[model samples]
Target: MTTTAPLPDAAPANWVDRYAPAWSRPWLRLGRFDRPTGIWLLMLPGWQGIALAGAMAGRAPDWKLLVEFFVGAALMRAAGCAYNDIVDRDFDAKVARTAGRPIPAGQIKVWQAWAFVALCCLISLGVLLTMGPLAIGLGAGSLALVAAYPFMKRITWWPQAWLGLTFNWGALLGFAAATGVIEAPALLLYAGGIFWTLGYDTIYAIQDLEDDALAGVKSSARRLGAGAPRAVAMFYAVAVALALAAAWTADLSLFFTPGLALYATLLWLQARRVKIDQPRLALVLFKSNTWAGLILFVGLAAGAGRV
Candidate 1:
């Protein structure tokens, strides 16, 4: 088992010091802002949902709404991370890779963390207020999922399921933002996003598998054991299938079909890479989903008559 030491308490280093503005580093750290991958992952599904909704409605997506969704996702994801860190501070301290996070490393106190969370949430709410009433209500309802997520690991062997529910919420919000209502196709896309999160998050959990076991944390990676790769493949298959069903229901054009095929190919590659258990490989495969998602969004946008 690999054990990560707590990062030293010192001045910000490298690009964090030179490029990141001095005023933002602490708050950024609070939100794991240095890790933009999480933000990208959170935003893509929302974009997909918006694109699909636009396609279904036979119009170009509202660019302002898309921008609003992006801003909201970034703010809320950061806020969610802050809240998660505060809730999991003790557990984070025990996990090597996470032991050096802002909270567990003592760079930020718990109360301060909560305050930061509130600040981020306020910023997010500001963005939410600009959306339609239905979007606002659906967005508010997501709070329950976010609030319950950090505690799921303590009681459930499938906390990844909870994460799937929480992380893919943007799918629902995006559709609502575009159409001002939720419908069957939007719900199907949201379900696909859930399975997508399950597959990717399971790969992510592998990085902490041994640590989680020793620390009494539960994850799908730990539960799946040697069959982890196979399980991921199965979940990805379901995700792709559901996504295709969503595209079909939305009456998307031929352009979207090729993108769906590409996405399925990418999932196969991810599954293949997961079988190797190389951390570096896993990280790369996870990051690749960002590109895969972008491609799918492009296809959807193209089919929706937006360039």
Candidate 2:
């Protein structure tokens, strides 16, 4: 499995030299932007929400709304990562896997990072304004969650729960974007996303368990101890069930059933593959979830377009 190497220079490298100005590379690294997996994870729930909304309305989803959601997801997810790096700079410096992150490795200054975050937020706000007023409001509300997320690990054993809330806000925003209103089905999808995040993030946290423990960081993986796999299974089970419930509540077509089943099978396989004692294996399993999310999205999109 390939992993991104941290930026090499001790001092900030020229933006043009790194990712090239045209690519906006400096901003991307500041947000761990090179990692496509994070954007996919962030965007899938929003897509699922939009598809479910379209299903509820018995219409094909607006393609423009879908495109807008994608753009918003990329910007917001990048911004969130930048915020996390700023907050976790000290903690990141202590962890081998994260020690080379832009902020901690001295490739980016804190205030400059903050400025990057503001710029990303501005871009996200532009996308938000293009959505419904309800979505725009909800998008604004999520700032509180994003602001609080970086500190959750310091104060609580379940930072993944906080992350769940922060990450899944897109579900509500997506539904509003699709239907111009928030509804019960969207709420259910958002709830399910929370559990799904818990499951996957627990697996992700497993990779950092040792470093986290040594650094006095708290996490569900450490809390679950030797029972990490069992806990992940329970979380995934709830996620699958809730996701199906969201679809059913929205009265989606039968086309969604097979996709949901496939997703369930994927989760089961992921659960079985989690090695509580092996951090690298845990990271691998966590990354595999990006595929799981995409598969689920394809199913939702298919179901949204009833023949």
Candidate 3:
């Protein structure tokens, strides 16, 4: 909101601008700490996975796993953002919203950004090491997806789908950490998360539609254009369906259904309000998913005592 803070999609009067020291603003901005919604978005699916896996096993979500996932999501999401900034520096310079970023604005050198990334990843690695063997393996396997994500816009119009894959890997990691095994229900949850990300990220992409086109970037928002709202609805529908399937297949009890309903209602509302012309609204809708995701997590956790 300040003249000094110019990222188009950044939260209004975010904490980073309000309170962070001037020397640390660039690094914090690089990690997107100003927009903490992304941290919740990244962490929530893993929390939901832990919830679902625990429900199926007749136990509550492991509080320690929830804590671990949050820490890991924060660090990894920061690392991923820094890496993406490094890779997309050229394209970012051409886009209005991203032009003010540390790398593109020359506030930080490339090597320094890389060093920041290394430090974040090193810390996230420490978090991952605390999880079980299966989780550690799954965490390592995700690097390939993370490494490839920056180039996705260049080669594919549906890069949001790839993000769905990358962002939702936490579901599998969470489930594995709780159960020490990957099963059908976990796969269903992961698939559902993919659709969920596709829906929400599409809304996010609307903010960049013009800039992306001008910069020769591809996104589902550009591909669908005015029909993006309808497409988002459909993607959310699939997400809800897969969530139902995951719950039913896992034998989660009746208590879980209402929370799922609440989560679905939130998505439907977001879809109804989504308009390609209203990029600011799109950003708000996209951020709202973090709360919706938490609704589903609470719903899944409720299932633990019943079935």
Candidate 4:
């Protein structure tokens, strides 16, 4: 039996290590199920869209929709991780932080990773089918973005921008699912999510700056270099602005302003606290976006109350 150790980037004492059968550990890790942050980040945009639409409808968020999105997000994020690992296996092998990933470390074969992607996608499709036609179409349209994302670093200095677009597709899907049509507020929320991903993922990229430089990978962190913190602040500011605009476009009440303010303050603190040299702190700030996003969701929901 192959005894798989946790990868360097995995959360310590993650559930996979404690509960997963030994044979399943490699597969679980390959999907990044152990790192729940990515899953949460990916899932939040969808929830935000749902909440925003619900707010516009003057009702509490639809818990059923939330549950559906939770499952869909987890499965899709896992599939995305597997596909990215498959595509970046060579790059992963050269980067210190990513070298221990299942594929690069030889814990899982390339073929198995593909099979896992198929399995996850099939399950996600089941969930997608449960939604309306518009949501399904939006979800299907996202495949092209996902397919192109892994290669963005090889061709552009702004892979994070591509990621911003790809990661926030849920904002569109969630709104369409709830409202049966895409609208301006959803577009605004999607744009806000793109900036949010750009900011946090840049912080995440900071952890890999040295390794990425050596590997010939381009990232906003490397491009911004010493000014990365300021750039993150700028990106986060745009995200907050766009999100506030989205709420206003939805005609959310004044109650949403406080949440937006808190969200902005948190992003400001992250910018002030960021030190590119501190990989641990970078990871902390990157993960902190999860809470920050949740705050924004709460604000959007509160503001959506009956005007």
Q: Model 4 — TM-score against the truth?
A: 0.98
TM-score of each: 0.92, 0.91, 0.98, 0.98
Across 100-128, the per-residue lDDT of candidate 1 in tens digits comes to: 88788776789988898898899989999
lDDT of 2 by residue, 67-128 (tens): 88788888888888988999999999999878877778776789988898899899988878
Backbone collision tally, model 2: 0
Where does the lowest 10-residue lDDT sum fall in candidate 2? 1-10
lDDT of 1 at 228: 88
Candidate 4 residue-wise lDDT at 228: 92
Cα lDDT computed for each candidate against the true fold:
0.81, 0.82, 0.93, 0.91
Q: Name the candidate that leads on lDDT.
A: 3
lDDT of 4 at 63: 87
What local lDDT score does residue 273 receive in model 1, on the 0 to 100 scale? 77
Q: Which stretches of candidate 1 lie over 4 Å from their true place?
A: 1-18, 21-23, 305-307
**Which whole-number lDDT from 0 to 100 does residue 79 have in model 4?**
96
Give the lowest summed-lDDT range of ten residues in model 3.
1-10
> Over the stretch 1-307, how does candidate 4's per-residue lDDT look in tens digits?
3876677667779999889999888888888899999988988999999999999998877889899999999999999999999999999999888887889889899998999999999999999999899999999999999999999999998999999999999989989999999999999999999999999999999999999999999998999999999999999999998998898889999988989999999999999999989998999999898999889888878976654
User: What are the per-residue Cα lDDT tens digits for candidate 3 across 12-96?
Assistant: 6888888888888888899989888889988998998999999998999999999999999999999999999999999999998
lDDT of 3: 0.93
